[model samples]
Target: MNGDWLTRGRDGRLSVYQLSGEAVRCRAERAPGGPWTAPRQVGGDQRLHPFLALGQGADGYVHLVSWRPTVKGEAGLVHSTHFRPRLAALDWNPVGHPDKKGDRTGPPAVAVDAQGRAHVFVRNKAGGVSMLAQKEKGGWDPWRDLGGEDVHDGLAAVTGESGRIELYAAVPGGVLHWRQEEPGARPVRQEPLRAPVRPGTLYALATSADRTTLFHTGTEGELCAWRPGDKPVTLLDSAGHGPVSAVRCELDGHDCTLLAQRSASGRVAFAAYPTEQESAGAWWTESGPRLTVDARVCLATDEDGRVVAATLSPSTGQLLLTRRKDEPGLALEAWREV
Candidate 1:
């Protein structure tokens, strides 16, 4: 029931993933924007945390990762792959703890490169960043330390326009970042951006082929948008306390970025604006009924090139989804329980 729960595959089928009873389950559309199928268990065990990180590559394979406590009571990471639209996920495989002593780890963040390899990142027990990457041929490389100290959990990773992976984590007084100079090359640490970002609220959107813009709630209780080498710009004053979900697509025949987040009143709010043009301003409009103040809202593009927003119901925990209406600017269809 995390924010990163929706994805679309190569065959134009949209899949919604959820974590229930420590097992990952999926409900996919029978066709693009069609009726959704029944829930099917995909992977996970009792040790799994409620968090799930999902990423899809150019080849349409969906990669999912989550944190689990090992038998030794130390935090560990497990990974699974969905090769096709309707196929069951591959068995959950341990990504292994960076520390042999099995020191507890944090939730994982993942991104798939252009070549279809999924790169996984997590906060190590020592408050630093560690990475494990999928090999070009097959198999995974040994866990490598990307190096950052005093870092918080809730890491964010995205594939850049050049197909290289970039990583970001919230630190005490600012944000730490890592970027690959070229596709398939090692990602090296970059200059950290100074901002008082709320931990567990770091979310990234690849606004363009090569550029990415980050959206998060600031420590001062405002929503901020930031790009590397640019100052953090405030987007909203009271964006609640959790993560902000964003997706980039064309709206009303114009390129735009759509964002969804819980408001201070415990309601999900939606906003749209020109991509990467935060200074032009964005207007936040309340959508759907009030949710818990901490509820997570997710935005993703469906197979039919329409925007979709998904969130969990407070009473029933059912997955509720709404789609962008065909007529106008930033309008959405009524919320439907899937």
Candidate 2:
């Protein structure tokens, strides 16, 4: 299976990682649409999934994690996820073993905190959340259990108002929140989200201004968001859109949220949610330029607040970068083929 993923480093370069069968291909640029470096392949086998999770550490290294799929006729195939995580510099040079023991039930998600520390979370073998923190220099702390039973799918994390990084998981009943308030907090605080959430990936964003928004794909596949202490709000009914994301941005000198989604038809779209004081909905809904694909899995915004995307091609089974035309608006730009 092929995978396509995008992330930004401290240097403001857009780093793209594409998985084709067993090889991982990488390319980076000072910025999206800039002169991309020559692509290079990292060794691996087809058993590995291409939908890798990526984050940039405060130390200036790119961190990635994806587990190998279970193979039939193997002793632990039914209970295996075999994770071999990697850490790379801005240049895409990797440092890690190709095979590590672990299991993951969903696509991984990662985030970097204010301290430049990299925090990664994934659903583990027991359908519970497992996390690993990258040390200042290199190496990862042993995967720690961030307990949650029946944790359905995707994982998300955000640096909270108090500068504490909180991780989220979707369980059958509601969204689960986990966090350690301080450096040596006793037990990781766990709480229930205000409302019921779908079993897909959970997305959370905490603005620097102290506003937090929680969004997810509902049981009916509709996009939903809820503010803390409030009822869940349905943003849009599903029409094959999956993998929702909200990134911190600026509009008219105020902090905003930039959202993106991939429709089942392979068309990727974007919308803008200005400050809560400004509106209750997207300023311009799904009006951005779109990229056609076999499946769009990853959508991210870089340090410059520009949205970037990637997708899988059913025909060629390769991952491709989705770029936008140099137009004025965030979602209004037309797509430019690279």
Candidate 3:
């Protein structure tokens, strides 16, 4: 719920709010023991998209991906890039020095593993999803095709408990998965997880702790889940007319899921579902009270069963973080912007 908590790590180091609301103000410090350092700007004038953060596995190195307006060969393009985490006095220099020659109108998702490697997922104009990863030893690898030969909007990635990497993309017709055994290896595509036949699109994908199940939603205002063997099941359905963005994590020591979707009136409402099964089962159940927050926001999770959400208050255009009190049996805890 600290909607403003920019990025958090499993080790309890958090880079959180510090400066002008329009830009990202982040500071790195140990959680549960912090006198958080002075906040610093990570993305210069870039105006980063939601969910940017310092990747896990590397010390003092952060990875950022953003879509900025640009002119490309007489046409307009949105360029995305990755930056390294540095001190404010150092002016936030980019770590890997990657070339800025790509399109970014589509949503681009980034993930950094335990080795400080950078993995990027973006949908190109050709309607195909492409991935670019940077290894500590090698530079940026060539862009590889991810499936779905159509426009894709939402992308999510996570490192599983087994250390294998999994990626989810919301493509034109449905959702797709990519799994890799190790770094620099080819990713194998799982079957397409089709979205509902309603008039919505899949916007986000989050996995359970085991990484075997996935949760997703789209413009149709429905929250659904997909496991390895079963068909996608609708968890929460909304009569509204906008897309739904979702985040999943453990809350209060139990599996928790959060689904946020825009209503017909443009207000964003979030629903929470708690894990009902002790082992892998059919579906997650709604446990706690539903909460609504600012519409234009993003969500993330930390290791301690805490949820970090980013939302811009339309009244002020300033970013805010909502921190929820932690409680047992609760699947998700909101962070307040205290």
Candidate 4:
């Protein structure tokens, strides 16, 4: 359950992270299309098969979250850390103990705001949501319960222009939504925005402009996104069981959202928006390439329009990074693993 495994720092560095072996590690390039440094262990308890969330604050600090499914990390705790985007290997500022009682249910989602505060949201074993925040200077605050029930995992969070932070997760009947308009302000609403799609894999289109659009595999393997208004937009006719992710890129002067999905064969594919600027509300998909069975996919943008992805291969349980360029007619070349 990785929220965003690849983040672009303010300094133009591209940092790639993944759950490697018993700990989480990161690899970075000095700038776009730059050479990447060797993978370096940032920090985490010695444990296997843990989940992670990653975000970069306005201050160019990369925030990391490492938590377990059944228990916390090896030290039996959910932990977090922050470090300079470029000099991360030289130093790490640990913001430990997400919950005082160390209670957790699944991997956490993180978002850092303009004031350099880190916000984390996660669902506990009881299916209630809890959040922990850490400001620029102070340590992590105590966990606060944001009441909701039976919320599925894969919580998503985003910060808005006016200090607004939004979080959403799947509930029994629909999505449970919450918002904090400003700092120190309580959540304005906590209710479900009806629609039950796939369970366990809730993906926020972090690649979308408003972050309001979400995509997940439907119960019957159909891919779904937020319709222009309330209804969900089902894209394509070949949807099958797969993983979903997206990246914002421009192709032939058309700024578009590149949607990636793995087919039953493990091949990833693509689709775009605004194909003709006013062709009605139609979204179509095209085949890309498949991945080996041992890999779980994650996508990122180089921020310069180059689409990048990193697949975690079980061979070494490390990221196998790839870069793809768009071809005419929205078709994509084979993903070249870097």
Model 2, position 32, has a per-residue lDDT of 42
- Per-residue alpha-carbon lDDT of model 2 for 22-125, expressed as tens digits? 44566677454476666555433334554566554444454555555554421111101111112232322222221234333566666666565666666666
Itemize residue pairs with steric clashes in candidate 2. Answer: 58-116, 288-331
lDDT of 3 by residue, 44-79 (tens): 665433433223333434455544333453212122
Native-vs-model 3 lDDT?
A: 0.50
Between candidates 1 and 4, which one is better according to TM-score? Answer: 1
The candidate that wins on TM-score is 1
Better of 1 and 3 by lDDT: 1
Report the C-alpha lDDT of model 4 over 7-70, residue by residue, as the tens digit: 7766666787766656777778866777778877765344534567776665667777665434
Q: Which stretches of candidate 4 lie over 4 Å from their true place?
A: 44-49, 68-86, 89-99, 102-104, 161-163, 206-211, 227-229, 237-243, 275-289, 315-334
Model 2 stretches astray by more than 4 angstroms: 1-4, 30-33, 42-51, 58-60, 68-107, 160-163, 183-187, 209-211, 264-266, 276-279, 283-293, 297-331
Provide the overall lDDT of each model, using Cα atoms, as 2-decimal numbers: 0.81, 0.55, 0.50, 0.62
Ranking by lDDT: 1, 4, 2, 3
Error of 1 at 92 (Å): 0.9
Each prediction's RMSD over C-alphas, in Å, is 1.9, 5.8, 6.0, 3.9
The model with the greatest lDDT is: 1
Q: Clashes in model 1: which pairs?
A: 161-209, 161-210
Cα lDDT, model 3, residue 323 = 43
